[model samples]
Target: MKTLLGSQDNWDVVENGHEEPVTTEGYTNAQLNALKVVRAKDKATLYLLYRAVDKSGFEKIANAKSSKEAWDILEKAKNGDERVKQVRLQTLRGEL
Candidate 1:
């Protein structure tokens, strides 16, 4: 996903922080563009995640404000897979 977004020039919205300063009155044009980019990217990510989620996870994350939040919630709701951990450990030990 990171590579896909980077190729499309939208990776910053998903993976990098927006560093543009905000004012009390409003945002500059560039800042506004950044905001729009982040919002659109977040919504796209959320939609993609939704399609791949189970009913229970969907219900739990339906109201998430952003894709990152939804992903964190979904992760927290899932059980830890010991088999996956063991595989990772085995791979690491092989590298030793």
Candidate 2:
């Protein structure tokens, strides 16, 4: 299955113990607008694959905070890590 998240998360909102808050208590118009763009981008990326998920599949990613997290969840659930995929490939080659 194709991973929904694109390679690299450029707009990281969360860090060690701090997160970019949606609250704009004392921000200029430009900062607020930029924040809005970041939020929209994050949400849009998350929903890109979310909307395509079937009802049962939706449950697996309903609470994902970012696209990468959601994509990883789906990948892991499908068949496990890269090692597993390589093993499966070898098995199929042998069978054939």
Candidate 3:
């Protein structure tokens, strides 16, 4: 997934997340176009992510604001959170 996104120059959007340009004060055409590009890439990434996961997994990232946020949520769900990892490691050490 990372490789795929990277090949299309979208990994940055999914890794760092794109900031939506503020529109309250109005913007130039260039700014709007730039935002459109970023938004398109982000939506594409999101579509890929949605297709990659199952129902339960989908639920986890359903409310994610961005690809990066969804990626993070999925990663933690699959790998477990830091505390969970620590506990698992402790159990392994005890078994040895």
Candidate 4:
């Protein structure tokens, strides 16, 4: 599993597991890379991943795609949607 730095709240597991005492540092590069890859393929996942990485990742993802698509992905992901998240995870794992 990958570990991210700069905020644990940006993780789906952390959110779902209701983990307490979120941290803002100490993430592995592999985890950060996975988060970036996930965000690139799905905006919703990107939003969640944002909580772990720097804001620059968000800007990059947003700039890489259309505003409409980015917003749509963020909205859907924020609403607890999982389809896109699953797809993003699969892509990150290179199982797609």
Candidate 5:
């Protein structure tokens, strides 16, 4: 007598044989974690920028008080501030 295997079992085997697909734009969990760390570093840079500016100026952007906020700030700065632009270039070059 022969035993029969279902399609679901065959699909499972195929899925198991392949590496898990990257969930976000080909980025794995480790890559995402690293990106989070980079965002945190960028946030620190924004904090430094806020310190350089006046208290009120700092508060205006401080509402975005997290890494994502800092990233947005950095993006804006890159467009308007020479220093920030340099930092952004360095970051893209993996030199920061």
Candidate 6:
């Protein structure tokens, strides 16, 4: 999946997430163009993520607004929360 996303030049967007360009009264053509590009990439990456997950995973990310959100949902579901991980590690080391 990482390889596929990287090939499409969308890995960065998925990994870092994008800051939506703000449009204002003073917005320039360049900003509008950048906004279009950002939206397009966000949708594309979201589509890829939606297709990659199974039914259960799909449920977790169904309302995600961006690919990064969907990716984070799957990551947390698979690896658990950071606190959970810490507790698990401590138990394994007989310190919990």
How does model 4 fare in lDDT? 0.47
Q: Rate the local accuracy (lDDT) of all candidates.
A: 0.69, 0.66, 0.86, 0.47, 0.50, 0.87
Order the candidates by lDDT, highest first — what do you get?
6, 3, 1, 2, 5, 4
Query: Where in model 6 is the C-alpha error above 4 Å?
Result: 81-96
Between candidates 2 and 4, the TM-score winner: 2
- Per-candidate count of clashing residue pairs (backbone under 3 Å): 0, 0, 0, 3, 0, 0
Error of 1 at 91 (Å): 27
Q: lDDT for model 1, on a 0 to 1 scale?
A: 0.69
Off by over 4 Å in 2: 1-19, 78-96
lDDT of residue 93 for candidate 4: 94
How do the residues 1-96 of candidate 6 rate in per-residue lDDT, one tens digit apiece? 899999999998898897764545687899778778878998999999889888998999999988898898889898876778888888999963
Question: Cα miss at 1, model 4 (Å)?
Answer: 30
Query: Model 5: per-residue lDDT, tens digit, 51-78?
Result: 6556655655677655345345645654
Q: Which residue pairs in candidate 4 collide?
A: 4-27, 5-27, 6-24
Q: Could you tell which candidate, 5 or 6, scores higher by TM-score?
A: 6
Better of 4 and 6 by TM-score: 6
Query: Which of the numbered candidates is closest to the native, going by highest TM-score?
Result: 6
What TM-score, to 2 decimals, does candidate 4 have? 0.22
Query: Could you give candidate 1's per-residue lDDT for residues 14-66 as a string of tens digits?
Result: 45433333552577789678677777777777777677677977898899877
**How do all models score by TM-score?**
0.59, 0.54, 0.77, 0.22, 0.34, 0.77
- Cα deviation of 28, candidate 4, in Å: 0.3
Give lDDT: candidate 6, residue 5.
93
